[model samples]
Target: MSTIARTPTDDATRADRTWTLDPDRALPADPAVRPIAREIYAETKALPLVSMHGHVPVEWFAEDRPFPNPADLIVVPDHYLVRMLVSQGVPNELLGVPAAPGSGVVAETDPRAIWRRFCAGWKHFRGTATRFWLETELVEIFGVTLRPAEDTADAIFDQVARAIADDAFRPRALLDRFDIEVLATTDPAWSTLEHHAALAADGYGDRVVPTFRPDPVVLLDSATWGQDVERLGEAAGEDVSSYRGYLAALRTQRLRFKAAGARATDHGHLATDTTPLTDAEAAGIYGAALAGTLGPGDADAFAGHMLFQMAAMSAEDGLVMQLHPGVLRDHDRGRHAVFGPDTGFDIPVVTEYTRALRPMLEAFGHHAGFRVVLFTVDEDAFSRELAPLAGVYPSVRLGAPWWFLDAPDAMRRFREAVTETAGFSNMSGFVDDTRAFCSIPARHDLARRVDAGYLARLVAEHRLDLDEALDTAVDLAYRLPLAAYATR
Candidate 1:
């Protein structure tokens, strides 16, 4: 019977390996810098996780039930894993991705088979951040001994299955075990937040909070825009026939989110243009949208105007605004029709910040109450636009490398790219920004390791003192995020 081991244990098929982890993973390879990197990593490795922005469902913690099985908990809901398998020609059905009604894609129902399929394609994850996180979770969290492969898939599955059955493996327990200090869940504008209320009743209000995400209501191009608008009106108890009423409804909902312990509002628009439209212009678009007569570009215009409006509201209410733009969401129209959004077909596009955001920045960039954290998948914007913007604007702070840029090499590049202009304090620090609840620690851990390596190189090059480097590491790992997103 194969159980578990912290270290490598002999196996028949692959006798050389028992566990898959390296102590010096993601640290600098330079012989002199490696020791310094290891020292810096050791100092920050035990810091509590501060996941200020993520997509973990609030219902999981509200319910606090044991996770069903390895596949569902680890595979089915993870678009990173599902998308990779799908890209390699594995059917979505075989990966247990449920198709939309009448789409005729029969999802794989057996958890064991799905897990087997995942193990057989483990090689696909090589050199990916998903691979690092999955291995860390298996070995460190579940204490699994065997590496994921076709032959050892059953043994590994049994180990994880038995481990999650314990009471300590529940969502709430995992939070404590993961040492997550604060976990913010992204919620839609019309959310009831009953799960958040329930968590509050259980004395976990401050520990877990909701973030206001109004994309469905703000972006007018959605097929469900009309229905979502009605739902938003219902949730906010406001009339929807007029433009003033629509803005009023959104404001009312934002206040509700604030009262629910929210500290930030998240916007994921396709463009970062925040040039405000005149009241007459906005009203005309709003009336047309309500009457189903919107012309082309009206939706884009209104969406950009809404971002400007959101900044004004954030100034009034004190919720930090988060903007991540430049993604062409649901690139594969056919797959999206069947599987819905976030199944990982979103692709990044060229993003600009200097002129695109000039109007909003000119309005609120120096406002005492207004604050916005800027993120991008387009790395070119780092030194050229984002860094300089955050460097100058008192209300701006550069968000950590987001989405496709969250991997180790990308993160290291981020620090090198922005630190010269923005420096350390003007950054929002590390945000896990994941839907996988279990990957929070691993994501943050990888950031810390990469930061340590980067800082160690600076120290080795005599650019920064070792003591200063250590202090900067602590700020990146913990202090900066706490201060950046602090509720006003």
Candidate 2:
């Protein structure tokens, strides 16, 4: 008897790959607008991309090694993939999540299996930035015409795998290929940055740099706060047990990062609240944080005070301060317990910048040496609060649509709402803000397309001329971000 091989159900899904790429699909149809947008997009698309904030693994640049597989390249490193798969009831382990602290589940070892699962679940990403980005990447980078459905899964994987195996796909090579002039990776305060040091020592200092993210050190409620604080102290050679000493330790670490080619500092707080607390109050809160007995209000106050302190430090030093607030992070306690933080459980909340930023603005908002780039998930605040705040304050500039808002519709809305009040100059242009390195070009390409479309509309409406719109598009795509954060 002869047996026939039965293909997996996931394989069927992989065969459905089909993508529509119309470079002119989103372009304005009116003759007047089309010409203006064409001119604008042509000028901006050629500028060198500047990625001021991202999560690309430093090892990719330091080691300059080939990526292992398509699944590892697209699935494992991206929260967008993991979160979507989890939402569809696919277990993270099946998608290759590592073992949790307490639970035991065998992670998928075979990249093909992981690819099959991801391919089967690709439909869940319809109408998302993920869909747009992946489609663009498949077309532009890998030369894949069809989208990754069940039937096309293996073929697509094989194609990407072959491409990655090529010498040209190395991280450093891709950095140059993508025309990325500057890329910053977020690193914790306790990190040694041996990889960053190595990259610089290897003479790649002009491209990759680290951004100091002090969340683990400032958030006393973190599970590893005590140990992280100790690590910070050890790195700084200061006694972080005391409030004064802790601040000193942070300063030392900031200097260390600066010496390692850091150009910016990032803060991921629950809210945008900032305070100018007296020394006594700060010291008391610092004492509580060290003892691990800080209350909710105490933690908020301490974080707020630290925001102002960070701004003061920025004024003294040169690192640009990036404040990303209004995320109700770790919303799913169960998922957080099982999978861990940054597993796509964070949700946006209504944020008030006018009141929350008063204390810090009152202290250092006028300082010319300090530059604060504010980001928001709340679109309502763009015209109402953020644009106005950035428009008036010499130290403040609006970061482009971020995270959930970094899409075509959201980008259009942001430009419409904020440009009238804040104008193009008050904005710092676009930052990809992605962990997925391969998606960098796609993300930037999407932004350029959207910006061109918007500029075309402006010219059609007689709000801007072809020359002005073209210049603005180039600034929004390239020059503004570099200039805004180029304090170093």
Candidate 3:
């Protein structure tokens, strides 16, 4: 494997370049801070990345196909890329987004056109973490020095296209090059898992696995909930029309996922409200939901009830339950009407966990077998509500700052706010919840660097020794998440 070299450029030319990662650029030249950060970075830099939760497709590993172009690999599938392009007045269809009704715009199929448009809007990502990650990927992975602008778009595109055609740049090869030991992709309960099975049978079981996400069954108000429930029933060999049969069917599907290498179950809901309703009330709600007559309040109650039921099921089945709540998905109805879900239209809403989770926690918070990891988009609740909850409840652990809060400043603020109360162990470490595959290593590298910088502050303040901080860095980078999500 030959290393790709960057073409030497003059200082003026380098200054104009926007998306390259120079070795010197990452260095902190401050005499005092540079050495301390360097030492901390060295200790954790080479640690294998642990991707407990992400949105990568299993077919990428199963088929091992060479990516066709930079646009297909980075633009079409990424909500970040699409959102940024939209903000710059670039039509989504022009970037290959599927056209919706009433929008007569056509998508651009040529890779060069998409790349040109995307580069022209590069300024939209200025000062954002997306820019940071993209630059790191271009430099470290693609070996490009010129920034992605209109002038250099064709050059960078041709270079990346050639590099991708190389055998070393294949998906599996990139996974090994990224030093990712294990990566778990989130799959809905109705998914067939055939791709995962093929990958496992083909001898990649140790590296890629599936995570069970049963949101369709829990969120009964969704358009396809009835169909999903019926499919789940078929998969589990249970009649899901009845409330008890539904729970049984869910358990069966979860167990099947566990056998297929699922170690955790992910829940994405509007809020974290949980309830342990009486059997009669639970049955009534379930029947209404099954009949497609559930009201707004009834839907909330059913979701809360399912949370408790899922916890109880986890107690028995040993799949770690992860609750990521407070996202108002597709808040812009117009965007949804056109682009559909996950088009970067989701927004964070204020969430209340104290009273919302009281009933459920009072029931299973102390249970030894049950483990619930709570993640919130509401930053205000980090120290006040979430930290205290995780600090007390034996089954509760805090998930890392996610989605809109996964940036460098957000991560730094999270450590500062929660470390004093919940400490590091009560947190579930880091997970890059992204759909972009090339950005995985870059995201992990940024997290490790920010964590090391935070630890350096602690060491400088004499609150933690250098040795202990080094161990904490390693755990935060590699061990804690793997242990937290690993099947007990």
User: In lDDT terms, which candidate is top?
Assistant: 1
How far off is model 3, as Cα RMSD? 3.2
Q: Per-residue lDDT of 1-488 in model 1, one digit per residue for the tens? A: 12324344544456235665788988988999999999899889999999999998999999999999999899988888888898899987799988898998888889999999999898899899888888888888998767788888888889889988999999999999999999999998998889999999999899899999999988888888989989999999999878899999989989998898899999999999898999999999989988889999999999999999999999998999999999999898888888887763889999988998998999999999999999999999999999999999999999999989999999988999999999999999999888888888988999999999999999999999999999999999999999999866
lDDT of each residue in 1-488, candidate 2, tens digit only: 01113345434334443455776644566776776777778887778889998989888899989999998888887887788888999987788776566665567889999998998887899778888888777778988755667777888889889999999998899998899999999999977889998998989886899999999888777788889999999988999889999999999989988889899999999888886789998899889877767866887788888888898898888899999999998888866777777863789999989999997887788887889999999999999999999989988999989989998889999999998889899888899899999999888988998899998898888888878988888889988998898873
- Comparison by TM-score, 1 against 3, better one: 1
Task: Rank the candidate models, highest TM-score first.
Answer: 1, 2, 3
Candidate with the greatest TM-score versus the true structure = 1
| RMSD in order of candidates | 2.6, 4.9, 3.2
Return the lDDT, model 1, position 42.
87
Cα TM-score per model: 0.97, 0.94, 0.93
Give the distance in Å from residue 299's predicted Cα in candidate 3 to where it truly belongs: 0.9
Candidate 3 residue 211 Cα shift, in angstroms, is 0.6
Off by over 4 Å in 2: 1-20, 29-32
Tens digits of per-residue lDDT for model 3 on 437-474? 99999888888888888887888779999999999998
**Residue 243 of candidate 3: its Cα lDDT?**
90
Q: How many residue pairs clash (N, CA or C atoms closer than 3 angstroms) in each of the candidate models, in the order given?
A: 0, 12, 0
Once all C-alphas are superposed, what RMSD does model 1 give against the true structure?
A: 2.6
